[model samples]
Target: MLGHEERYDVLKRSLAREARGFTLIELAITLTVMTVLILMVVPSFTGWLNNSKVRSVAEALQNGLRAAQAEAIRRSHQTAFVLTSATPAPNTVASTSGSGSNWYIQVLPVYVGETLDPNPMVQSGSFGNLAPNVKVTASPATASLVCFNSMGRLVANSDATTSTNFGTTCTAPTGNITYDVTLTGATHPLRVLVGLGGQVRMCDTTRVLSTSAPDGCP
Candidate 1:
């Protein structure tokens, strides 16, 4: 019911209100809140990312050890699980690195001159390519090489020729052989435990192994 001039004035006021979205103080407060929230989330996100990398590396190593054990049982012969920094190949004689990121499995000859398959490599896997920053360390340090007998149980191998250039020898573990996988920013480092019976499992290193805490490790 207003006149043209009054209608135009009302329209102008409405437009002005619409255009005045956020004040400078409001914008500054909003930006400060958002920055605080982001700061709170970044550390948690980074920790989660690092922990995921540790777990991924641990699981890969656990699966490789299990595959080696299964191969030994299936072939009804001795097999070697060697952790090395070198590239793995059927014809390659790789050495062991205690903190290696790659793993190689092969059927081992019973004796020095025994003739078996020319290419004894069963499987090869890598954790380095997946999580380069993650560190893998064996507990005994000398347990970079593990051997499994026909019965899928840990065994000792005195043969220096099993793995070349590293003087790696497979010795039966007195107890569980553990490989700790960790990252610098990770909150939950993981451990891949290889039992003397060739059982392989992954668990959190931050907790104790218990009925209530299945993800824990000793």
Candidate 2:
């Protein structure tokens, strides 16, 4: 029942009311909720990232060991997988190590021509330089060097078990010898074990090995 001009004025006021934005209180509440959500998600995401990094390094180390074992069998020559420090860039591929760099893999043909080559080494693969934050460490400490002969048998370290060299008889060490390469991060660690039987496996050290069935370390 209103006139046209009054109706137009009412419509303008309604539109103006509808166009108003949120108040400071409403914005503050929304920001608080978003902040809480982000805070909750960030820690879990960080933990998952750390766990993934550690797992990747562990798998890489395990793969390096397996590759060396396979190469020893395939070439019918003694091969060694050594954990050494990373070389600097541009010379990254060079199989040299320094005392300060992170862990890296150097695969060497331990012997050739029925004698230990003066520089019996061929660069197989490298790690650690790319993953500086992750730490690759050994349990026995002396496991930094491990070798497999032409027979695919693990060469024993002199400190832990029987000692033998390339072009010499490889004696199997007594019992089930295990060298644990642990990849540690901010939250968790992954353990990769190399056995005398030429087996490489990854295990979760947080759980019991024997009692936890398939979920435990081997």
Candidate number of the best lDDT: 1
For model 1, how does the per-residue alpha-carbon lDDT over 158-202 read when each residue is reduced to its tens digit?
Answer: 774544323667776889999988889899989998888777889
Worst 10 residues of 1 by lDDT: 159-168
Question: lDDT of model 1 at residue 122?
Answer: 76
User: 1-218, model 2: which lDDT tens digit per residue?
Assistant: 99999999999999999998899999999999999999999989878877777777677777877877887888776666656564423223323221112333223434332444344344444554435566665544445556676676788523222122222222445434343333344465667776767777887766667764554675
Alpha carbon deviation, residue 149, candidate 2 (Å) = 2.5
Steric clash pairs (candidate 1): none
Highest TM-score: which candidate? 1
- The local distance difference test score of each candidate is 0.85, 0.57
Give TM-scores for every candidate, taking all chains together and pairing residue i with residue i. 0.91, 0.70
